[model samples]
Target: MTASWPPAPLSVDEPVGAPTLLPARAYVRAEVLAWERRHLFAGTWSCVGRVDELPAQHGVTVGDVPVLLTRDGDRTAAFANTCRHRGHELLPDGGSADGRVVVCPYHAWVYTLDGALRAAPRFRDVPGFSAADHGLVPLPVEVWHGWVFVNATGDAAPFTVHLGELAGLVAPYAPEKLKLAARHDYRVRANWKVIVENYQECYHCPRIHPELCAVSPPNSGHNYDLPGAWVGGAMDLREGAETMSLDGRSRGAFLPGVDRRRVLYLALFPDLLLSLHPDYVMTHRLRPLAPDTTRVECSWYVAEGVLDASYAERFWDRTNRQDWAACESVQRGLASPHFRPGPFAPNEDAVQRWVTLIRRAYLGTPPWEGQ
Candidate 1:
């Protein structure tokens, strides 16, 4: 390692005024992945899952900790999933304790919907034992649009502040009111960042995703400024295409208030990849497992009355597999001892911005506190 960002920069590998890629080691090193898990994911507003996916279940795993998300009527709450006594899991692993109140399955300790300790078995006469101190360990949670996001440490910036102008940008679509049509899961054989970089750019679409290029011209898009913490933009649909299908045909009604012919793609920093089409919305949440492996959960959501998402799901699943194959190939190539990052293309502006952001975050922040 050196004084320079990413230890070494291969400026000679590409042209001047071009963005440099992150070092290969950053994607392959274990300690680097650990640092990202702690700083970039843990305290951040990690999207556990959507409200519609797990209808009655409230438990989720963020990083290594299990956090619970519960709703009572119009109210919602989040907290550590362990009971105050005996540290037993208040909710079974990845299962729900949903009802009027959360009951610890172990000792029958009970907690209110708001995570307040209500009953503690039969231990009554313990002097100075305060229920106030034993209330569930609360975690900050926000149900943005339709997605549920949680901040484990409860010290990160407020969810709205972190989102910035993102709310107003997508309000016209009323994504909160959208309904899930289909869901799919995959174990991607590539790093999380590789998948993200692939999603943000279409430079390889012409070669790798002919099905995608058939619907929308890969070059017919403009990148959006930082509306919030997210980075994304839109691509114009071809003359006759109504949505992003294999042949650019609509399988559902156009979304409410959507009159234009374009598709919106956004990487809601850290984890969520959001794509908004004329008639539906698709999202991919990246879960980094090891340095070279990631798990991607994809769901297609359509507005009310749009029916099922068979068209959209089949289309994107094929496209997603194509991108994943390429990413896995890139990862294999990057593993070589002499690999170096190449320059960013003019069309890869979103990829460039993402790389710069990651580089700054990695280099600007001290590796550890008080170092």
Candidate 2:
């Protein structure tokens, strides 16, 4: 849970300090991606899906690790997706099991929803093969604000520690009461870091994002470098703008305690992009597919009575495409042998800090070891 982040905004009139970016090989090399899958993604808390979206016996991939989420009695639970009988995958990729039990396709090994071994057909005579010792391996899981997250390594700090004081800042939205109203899954032909960097810095907003600029100034926000594993800040909305829609007007009723004129954007390391607005909350969950490809699941949650978010969806769909285009261009650009890593802009402090954290992880360095 240790991270380099900020909680509040710094009121600075001028941008300061430019840091060098990561090398090109980090983006285009398969070896780097392999290192990240093992060292970085394996140990971190990665979100798989939402509580409501999960089935009775759900299977998902957390980074490179396959995990299972299920309802054990009344509480939700997580376990390794591998079966003990000859090491068969319970759900293969990402899908739901039959009813409340997992039936391995290779062999008819049955496991209950909570990962308890139920039956191993035709294996009664196998020596030293006990069903008790073959239950699915358990993993640490936490359901925070309706999002279901699992730790692949089973040893990271609790999700509470991961949130720290940042939890208090997000409490005003009453996220647990919100419901998923819209979702968009994307496949971007770019490294995940490239997409993350685009989210962190708005220095390019003036040129590519005219609609966003009309609602909120690109450089009119403050960045947080708080005491948790996340970095975020808010940009005040334009005086005439009500929300991030085509017309800058709200699409639904305001959230419970979010009577504000700004929008919150932050990233929980590894892969969670959170944006809090007056009427709803939007989240982007990332999964790296290759060295140069990533899968993004973007979802928006609205308050109980507020149903539709068509306008909001349209606005972000356009904005998201623009951002993805930029990221894809950067990915293609990184393939050039002449392209050298550039220095981060003075306004990209958040990106620099977050990138530093990622670099440390990709290099297999613990957050507290080097600093």
Q: Pick the candidate with the highest TM-score.
A: 2
CA-lDDT, candidates in order: 0.78, 0.80
- Stretches off by above 4 angstroms in model 1 are 1-17, 54-57, 105-107, 364-371
Tens digit per residue, CA lDDT, model 1, 1-371: 11122322222132365568888877888777776776567656788887655434377777657787788766667898888998887775578754777888889888888888888877677888777778899888888888888876566667776676666667777888888888889998888989999888999989998888888999988987653556777898889888888888887878778746899888876899989888888899988899899999998888788777798999999998898899999999889898978888988998877776566557543211111
Q: Tell me each candidate's TM-score.
A: 0.89, 0.91
Q: Which one wins on lDDT?
A: 2
- Candidate 1 lDDT (Cα, whole model)? 0.78
